[model samples]
Target: MISTVPHNVRGVAASCPQCTSSLGRIWHPDMRIPRGWALAAGLFYLLALAGPFVQISIFGRLQRADIATGPLQLTVQGFDLVGFLVLAVTIIFPGIKLGIVLLTLFGIRLEHQPTRFLKAIFRWYPLIGPWAMVDVYLLGFLVAYTRLTAMATVHLDLSLFALVGLMISMAALDGSLDTGAIWDALDTGPAPRPIDADHRGGHLIGCHCCFLINRAEPGMACTRCDTVLRDRKPDSIVRSWAFVIAAMALYIPANLYPVMLITQLARTTPFTIMGGIVELFAAGLWPLGLLVLLASIAIPLVKLLSMACMLIEAQRPSGRHLLGLTRTYRFVAFIGRWSMIDVFMVSILVALVRFGQFANVQASTGAACFAGVVVITMFAVESFDPRLMWDGAREAAPETPPDPTLIAEPA
Candidate 1:
C-alpha cells in the first residue's frame, strides 16, 4: 500500500521536519456527554426535587418535608453538617455541572480556539460528572430513613418533590451532555487526529527536544529540526514494573477500609464498597447490590490493572498492543477519580445524617484511608504519562555519524 505519511520521522529521535497538525472539528451540539451520564444526573435532580412530596407512614400518622424547607431547613434545627452536605452534593454540585455543560454545549455552540478557561473546564470534566449521584444518595437515605421510622409514621412533604425534581434535572443534564464531542471541539486545530492506525515504521517517531508524540516517514528526518531519532526505550520494562508496584500498594486498603458507616437504631455497620454490596445482596436487594459492585468495585480494579499493563508496555516501547495500551492508560487516568464514588457517598452520608444521639453518621479513619487510595491511584495514573508509550515505537539512529569526505559528488 502507498504510504499516506510523507518522509519517515520514526528514524529521527529528536526532531520533526513535517509541520504540526491537530485534530479539530465542529461537533454536533448534543454529542458531548458520555452515554446516559448527563441524562442520569438530570433525572436524579428531578427525583430529589420530588423527594419532599413523596411520603411514607408509621402507625396511623403521616408527616412531610419540602425541598427548600425539608432536610435542607434542618440547618435551622442545628443539623448543619447534614444540611450542608445534602445541599451541596444533591443540589449545588449537580446544578453547577449541568449549567457548565449547557453553557459549553449550547451557549458556546460555535467551536473555536480552546481558551485557557475551556481547557481547564475540560480537565475537570470527570470530577464534576460523577458528583451528580442524587439517586444513589436518595437510595441510601430512603433505606436509612425507613429503618429509622419503624417506630413512627414517616411522611412526605415538599422536599420530596424537590428531590424528585433534582433527580430528573440531573438525568436531563447527563443524558444531554456529550464529553468526547466536547473534547473534539475544544481541540480547535485543523490537523487530523495523530493516533496511529497501523504499526507502520515511518508514521511513528520521537521528538528529541521533548520526548513527545509525533509522526514520521520511513528514513525521514525529524519533523521538528530534521534530526534523526532512533532510540527505543532503554528501560521501558523495568519502569512499568515500578508503576505496577505503586498501584498495588494503594489497591489493597482501597478495598479493606470502611467507605460508609450505617447506623440504625443504636446498631452501626461499617461498610466498605464491597461490604455495601454484600449487605445489599444479603438483604435480597439484588439490583442495588449488582449496581454497587459494578460501579464501585469492578470498575476500579479493572482500571488499575488496565493502567498497569499499559504503562508497562509503554515503558518498554513494545510494538504489540501500543494502541490498546494507549487507550487503557487514558481510561485508567480518566476514570480513576470516579472510583472515589464510595468516598463521596461517605461524604454525603456523614453530612446528611446527624440526629445527634437519636441517629448520626460520621466518616471514619477507614473511609479516609480508602479515599487516599482512590486519590493516590488517580495521581499515579495522571503522573505516569501515557505519552511515554510512543517512545518505544520510534527506533533511534546508530551512533556512527556519516563521514563528510565519503559524501557523493554533486551530479
Candidate 2:
C-alpha cells in the first residue's frame, strides 16, 4: 500500500511499504512541470540526432558525424556489442524515456483514468532513467573533442548545442516528475488489497519493476505487472560475486592495452587508458585528463573494491555500518555506468576520425576489455541485494544495556 509521511512542512515522502522503495516526494503548492519539460526535451533530442553533431578537418579533409555514426561505425568495425550499447544508452533509451514521460503526462491530462499499458510504460521510467546516459555521453564527447583537437581542426556543430539543451531539458524533466502524484491521478480502480501480515512469516515481496507489494511466493507473478516476485533477488550474492570476479579479471587488460589505436600518416600510436590521460595532461587539458583518469581508471577500481568490501561485510554476522554499506552499494550502482564514458568516447572517435591513414581511430583490444569491466560491474551492482547486509545485524544480540543512572527514582 502507498504510505505518505511528512518529510518536512513543505514536502512529504511517499513510499511503498513492502519493498520500501520511494514513490516520490509531494511538494507543498505542487510546483512540478513535467509535461512542458518532457516535450521540450523530446524536441531537443530530435534536433540533437537530426544533423551533424560535430565536424572534423584534418589536412583539408572534412568529416562530420551525427549521433548514429558512433554506433553504426562500431557495428561496421565488428564491435557490435559496444555499438548496440552506445545506441541504447545514447540514443534509444533516452528517446524512449522522454517519449514515455511525455505520453504519460499528456495521458494524465487528457483521460480521467490512465490505462494499464500507460501505467506500465510510466512504471518503466524510473528503472530505465539512469541508463539514458546522455550526460555521460556528452562528457564522452568533451573528451573526444579534446583528443580530436590535438590531431585535427574540430568544430562543434548545431547538434552539439542541441544535445546540451537536450541534456538540460532531460534533467529538468526528471526533477519535475512526481511519480506519487502521477500514480494518484491514475488510481481510478479499486485499491489493491494489502498483503496479509501473517502470510508466510509476514514476508512480503515488492515487484522490482513496478514496486507493487504482494505476499512472498515462489514463481508468483506480480498482479500489477507480470514480473516474478521474490523475497530477495535470486542468488544475488553468488551472481554478484561471479560478475565482480570477472570484472576484476578484465580490469587488468582494460588499463594495460591501448583502448584506441590512432593511425596518423602511417605512424600507428596506441593509447592505453593511462597513456591517454598523460597525453591529455601533456596537452595542457588537465581537466579532461582528470576526467578520463576518474572515469576510466579510478571508477572501475573503486567499484571493485567497494563491492568486495560490501560482500565481505554482508557475509559476516557483524553488521557494523549497515547504513554506510547500503549507501556504498547505491553509490556503486549509480556510478558504475559512468565508466562507460571512455567506451562511448572510443566509439565516437573510431567512427568520426577515419580519413584513410591520414588520420584514423580504431578500437583496440583494451576497448572491449574496458567495456567488459563497465558492463560486468553494472551487472554486479544490479545482482547485489543491500538487504542482505542488514540480515546479519538483525540476528545479532543487543550489545549494550539500558543505563541505570538515567532511570528515574521510584516516587
| Tens-digit per-residue lDDT, 236-297, candidate 2 | 88999999999999999999999888999988999899998998899999988998899999
lDDT scores of the candidates, listed in order? 0.52, 0.80
Clashes of 1: 112
Q: Judging by lDDT against the true structure, name the best candidate.
A: 2
Cα-based lDDT at residue 4, candidate 2: 32
Taking all chains together, each candidate's TM-score versus the true structure is 0.53, 0.87
lDDT of 2: 0.80
Clashing pairs in 2: none
* Model 1: per-residue Cα lDDT over 1-411, one tens digit each: 111322222221121111111111122344544334545545555555554444443333343443344334435545455445546655676777765665555434555543446555545555566555556556545544433454344555665555656666656555445454465456444554455445444456654322324566445554432345544433444554555566577567767776555666677877766877777788787776776676567766786677667765664556666566766675675565445445445543444455544445566555555545555565556456555655545542223322211111111
TM-score of 2: 0.87
The 10-residue segment of model 1 with minimum total lDDT is 15-24
Model 1 ranges with Cα > 4 A deviation: 1-250, 260-269, 330-338, 351-359, 396-411
